[model samples]
Target: MSAATTTEQTLARYYHLHARLYDATRWSFLFGRSDLQARIAALRSPQRILEIGCGTGRNLARLAHCFPAAQLIGLDLSADMLARARTHLRQHRSRVILRQQIYSQPLAPAPGFDLIVLSYCLSMINPGWEQVIRSARQDLMADGLMAVVDFHDTRWPAFRRWMAVNHVRMEGQLLPELQTHFQPLDSAVRRAYGGAWRYLRFIGTPRPIVHR
Candidate 1:
């Protein structure tokens, strides 16, 4: 199996086991989610929004509320996660669409979404995170926005190792790549749990694609 496939399988199994507990436990550590959404709302009123790795639909529900007229799509690699998302977002069912798939490439019929979000999801995507970043650029409309909130890195080795076991790589890696593909609109890194770790929030527009 390819590295992406392997990572997907591992994440599927992980979420399958943890889906029930996810919403309950995540709020303690998953900082910047609400802030990220607020920042996105400040920037644009997107007509169509997509959230990659929209586990349990927490942000999807928020997006539905924030942009009531918008069409929302939540894509994930875990059925378990999407199943929870389905329940969590049922009130907005008419506007919300959930899909179970690993996002390795652009969705067909290019220039798809006005806003794409990744909330604490990219860190777990070890080998294929960069590919997903590029794919997000491709999937976006010419003036599309991409917003991300995720673990940045930790100073403690033990904490880093623990996160690694959970399939997250936190080494302050995602920001530079995101900057490379998108023009920065808003970006910041903040400490979590009194310096236990750091998390980043970024909102950017797709940089004009250069074709040779």
Candidate 2:
């Protein structure tokens, strides 16, 4: 199998057991989720929003409250994760659409989403993170926004390696990639747990596609 496929399988297997405990366990570490939602709500009232790797639909459900009139799509690769998401987001089912898939390419009839979100999942994507970012750009409308909140990097080697064991790579690479594909509207990296690690929040809109 290809490396991307391998990465997908790895994440699937990892979340299989973690999905049940995800919502309860993640609160301590998965910071900035509510803040990111608030930031996005304050900036735009997008008509359509797409969230990549919307694990357990935690953000999606909250987003439903944030933007009551917006259509929401929550895409995740793990069936187990999507299962939890379905149950967690059932109340908003009328407006929330959940899909089980990897975001390797633009969705059909591309450039349709007014807001795209990557929350605390991109860092775990291993070999496919950059491709996912590019694909998200294609799926974004010309005036649409892309919002991300994820691990930036850890200062301690041991902590970094520990996160890697959980399929996360926190080397501060995502921000630069986001800046390259979009025009940054708001971005910041802040320390966490007394400098043990840092996380970032990036909000941007797609840049004009240049042809060589």
Candidate 3:
């Protein structure tokens, strides 16, 4: 199996064991989720929103509240996570759609979405994260927005190693790649836990495709 495949399986297992604890435990450290949503809402009134790796539907629930008329899709690879998301987002069933799948390519046959979100998911994707970013560009409308809130990097080597064991890469890598494929409208990195680590929140529009 490829490295990406192994990583995907590993993450599925990890979330399977942790899905129930995710929402409760993650809030303490998974900073900037609400802030990211606010930043995106400030910039656009998206009618169709797609959130990749929407664990436990926390952000999906927020998106539903933020955009009352928006049709929302929350995609995750973990069945356990989706199960929790389904229940958590039950109230918004009319507007929210949940799917279980790895996102390495564009959604077929459907028109692009007005907004795409990745909340704390890109870092766990290991070898395929860059491809996911590129695929998101394809999944977006010409003037669509992409919003992300994720771990940026850490100052402590020990903390980095611990996060690696948990399948997260915190090396300040995502922003540069995001900038390459999208035009930044708003982006910032904030310190967490007194600067032991940092996380980023970004809102951007897809860069115009360049014809060769």
TM-score of each: 0.97, 0.98, 0.97
Weakest 10 consecutive residues of candidate 1 by summed lDDT: 101-110
Over 93-168, each residue of candidate 2 has an lDDT whose tens digit, in order, gives: 9999999998988996668899999999899998989998988999999999999999999879999899999999
Candidate 2 to truth, TM: 0.98
- CA lDDT of every candidate: 0.93, 0.91, 0.93
Query: Model 3, stretches more than 4 Å misplaced?
Result: 109-111
User: How many clashing pairs does model 2 include?
Assistant: 0
Between candidates 2 and 3, the lDDT winner = 3
After best superposition, candidate 1 residue 68: deviation in angstroms? 0.4
Residue 144 CA displacement from its true place in model 1, Å: 1.6
Candidate 2 C-alpha error for residue 29, in Å: 0.8
Worst 10 residues of 3 by lDDT: 103-112
In terms of lDDT, model 2 sits at 0.91
- Expressed as tens digits, the lDDT of each residue in 49-143 for candidate 1 is 99999989988999999999999999998988889899889999999999998889898757889999999989999898999999999999988
List of clashing residue pairs for candidate 2: none
Residue 67 Cα positional deviation in candidate 1, in Å, after optimal superposition: 0.3
